[model samples]
Target: MEFPPLPLFTEVELKSEIARVATFKKVPKGETLIRQGQYLKVLPIVVSGAIRVFQTFEDREILLYYVRANETCIMSLTACLFNNESASYAITDAPTQVLYIPSDYITDWQTRYPSWNKFILAAYRNRYDELLHEFTDAVFKKMDERVLDYLRNYRDTHSVHTIPISHQALALELGTTRVVISRILKSFELEGLIGLHRGSITLKKPF
Candidate 1:
């Protein structure tokens, strides 16, 4: 399938330039798009599916945010603009198609193209809000509450009640141990809030 066009830059010249230089690729689930400590050479825009961005410390990983269709990774944009190594890594959460714009033109376009500048600033603002919300949740919410929120968010994002994910994978994303997540999931199942399967969990009621 042809890569979906980004509605970011409205200027005919800017849009044409992007289409001329940007490359698209399809990646399977679990494919790493960016690695921590590596300098970014391109800024990726998600055309479809999702990419999970996260940081890892001492073998434990915590999710920063997800890049869904029509969205780009602000962290990648920052690294590309500043010529710095990435602080976090990104992996495809599902089969995904991404449009990669070479880093060479990012900063130049900011000053040369008004629409590009606006798009970049807007991306930054959106990502900042998401990060702030994540920080607040981490500071104020209990583990069980956080898990419930994660499940609910996933359900809403994917438009599905049944989430096909492993407990271990969920724990990694939540920055917790699998045992703890399993216990909490079991409790949720007992409470009739969810139904836990061997490799997935189904939401039974709206929360």
Candidate 2:
């Protein structure tokens, strides 16, 4: 498949390596592209939009990070590099376009293409920084403060005052129990900061 001009690829690589294995795909919003324990066969590079990367622990889930346009998922890269099953799930947060490369070509491409190696290293470093922030939030932030920040960030990014998410989903994203989330949301409602709906939360006032 033909790809748009990628940032770091030689003319030789474009002609010789990419054409042999890369495939282009259009993914719709809310689609699950990768599931935990799934076999690693393809590596996806986002050309547009967001992919939510998270891990499921039994009955609950915790968001790990997001893979946006021009970025790759470190968990997927690790799975492909180590030749193991996927350890986390990836879902499209919005309709997206992506370039898919067969995992078989990863080793050779990295070895033969310095630009590809640089891209992979840069992606890893970026994810490491995000993980560091996540650790800091978990260790130092209070639950209510973190939840408020999460809602504010979510609203700002989606450009909507109403967040269409369930308390269960919010709990999973925040790494807390649903009951706890419900209690906190109720508290927010009582404080007139937000209003709770059947499956969503509407911001009533700034936090």
Model 2: per-residue Cα lDDT over 175-205, one tens digit each? 8888988999999999999989998899975
Model 1, 1-207: lDDT tens digits are 475676766888988888789999999999999999999999998888999999988877878899998788988998998999999999998999999999999889999999888878888898999889888988999999999899999988888999998999999878789999999999988888998888999998656
Score each candidate by Cα lDDT: 0.89, 0.86
TM for every model, in the order presented, reads 0.91, 0.84
Q: For model 1, where is the 10-residue window of minimal lDDT?
A: 1-10
Give the clash count for model 1.
Answer: 0
Clash count per candidate: 0, 0
> How much is 84 displaced in model 2, in angstroms?
1.0
- Worst lDDT 10-window in candidate 2: 1-10
Which residue pairs clash within candidate 2? Answer: none
